[model samples]
Target: MQRAITAIYRTRDVAHLVRDELERLGLARHHITVIHKDVRTADPNAADTSGTVDPADGIVPAVGTAGGAYVGAGMVPGAYMGAMPGYGLGMPAYSEADLVYADAFDALHDLHLPEEDTRTYQQAIRNGDYVVSVEVDEDADIARIQEVMRRPEDVHDLTELDKTYRDAVYAPRRRPPREGYRDGMMGRRADLQNSPTTRDYIREEPLWPKGGTA
Candidate 1:
């Protein structure tokens, strides 16, 4: 089994340099995977006129919106977390953490890394730098590639790669609150409950009546 030796680079230039060197050292170019931030590909939510829905769209995104429904509400101990049948409060888009992981591990399953290194490579790319992972069949190749890619100022292992990436990318920055606009779960719930039509329905029949006022 081949082991993956991976490192993160601060720049695409250096990442390409190391990749070329790895090829010269006898590793095949196809054996190396380069991961970097691509602005064009970053926005999965970008308007898609293509009409093809990504399968992941159903899995990861639906988890949040459907979580409440799956858990159930009204008399259930965890009612607050669950959605009622008619309650269409809202669903959240993907979070930064989930998207980062998804992007970092894109197509990684096909690379066939050794079991131990799979975890290492997955965690190393979370910082969002140009990450390179090469499948080397020999221990000697791992040593050579590491030497070729290691920077004098950094630790060379995953830790230093993560540090370099964090320094380069500022992530999960707070979006400026919408001025005078309600947002987030509370806002969405309030909007749903207060809508003229929904308000009438809730008042007349109430999906989950509180204190017999329905």
Candidate 2:
């Protein structure tokens, strides 16, 4: 049976280094995954060659504008200000942070961890930590994987880290230009609530050439 072993790092750099080390130890890149926030900024000088506005950027504002106009005209109810599109209901759209949380949750869920443990792991990611998980088919490789991942100085034991940050709160520093409506509609949107099954943000493909198992 394949089993997953995971570790948390305080920074993405260290987590990535550890992942490289794991690959060096003969684990297939596909057998390991990293879950973290998408912090990359788009280059301003980069031409919009695609000439496409991201839906996340475009749709939310349109919804808010239409909703506001209708509400002001007394045609639509005020309660539906931030309702998400395409659901045929007034569900709020998820923020980028929420999507990251969902991605982290889905990645952890693949391990079949207990619900509480999964939440704790997800919270770790939300707290600006990076998660590196490895799936090993051989029981003998578990110890080696753990050793490699935990060698970093800033690595933390999940439960202990949870206790340290349990009372702390996280607020995203940046928001998309038109996210005001979404934020006003729903702030923080239920804290790690969404459990999207798709691994939209995972890195599972083999990064190294095919090789024999460790």
Candidate 3:
């Protein structure tokens, strides 16, 4: 089986997360190499199933060697990192999910999709969708997604994504602020207005005991 590593993140947390996922998926530590780009298609035979294997992810690793190592939050199946044809943009792509397979490299690219449907790509474009070449130069494989977007004349205020995000942000809080302590805590006035004991003490002053006048 061919092996590779791709770090689809800038921070160590992302690297760790991908590593954990790979390990969880049964890719051995030795079979893994870490870098900044996906390398599933460098070889005509090697493959990536993460849905982001692009033609520009640099060179292919030798069979049994980890392909490429990198990190990114948008690393999805069939994600093609680097730049490619017909984009007409100056900045390169930032996010690309490497779709690895046991057979060969499959490319995924934006531009072909409508502006809205290609969000994950736009996010990568704006962000530093990292692609560090380990054993080869990165090439963003350009592939098109075959999905239909259903635009409506009305707004979708009830989208699940919106609801979930709002729920997470504005959910009823579990606990409230501390309460239950409001008494005199100040100065000469506090002495007069404070605890019942303090009032009693003041009333029994020696100079004016009970109803006695001096």
Encode model 3's per-residue lDDT on 1-214: one tens digit a residue. 1111122234334434444444454434333323322333232333433444332322223222223222234344323433224322332222233222111111111001122212332232223332111111112110100000011221111223223333231111111111221121111111232221111011111111123211
Give the per-residue lDDT of model 2 (tens digit) for 1-214: 2345667778867877887898799876655666654322222333323222232221111111211111111212212332233322443333444553432343344333444445556677777877676655534455566667765477876657657656543322112222232212211112232122111121232212234221
In model 2, residue pairs whose N, Cα or C atoms come closer than 3 Å (at least 3 residues apart or on different chains), thus clashing, are none
lDDT for 165 (candidate 2): 59
Model 2 TM-score (2 dp): 0.49
Candidate 3 ranges with C-alpha deviation above 4 Å: 1-9, 25-40, 43-107, 110-117, 130-214
Which candidate has the highest TM-score of all?
A: 2
Candidate 2 has its poorest 10 consecutive residues by lDDT at 61-70
TM per candidate comes to 0.41, 0.49, 0.20
For residues 1-214, write the lDDT of model 1, one tens digit per residue. 2244556566667777777887789765545556543311122333323232232211111111111111111122212222224222332322445343432343332233333434444544554456565544433444456577675443235544334444333222111211222221110111122111111000111111122210
Measured with C-alpha atoms, the lDDT of residue 98 in candidate 2 is 54
Q: Identify the candidate with maximal lDDT.
A: 2
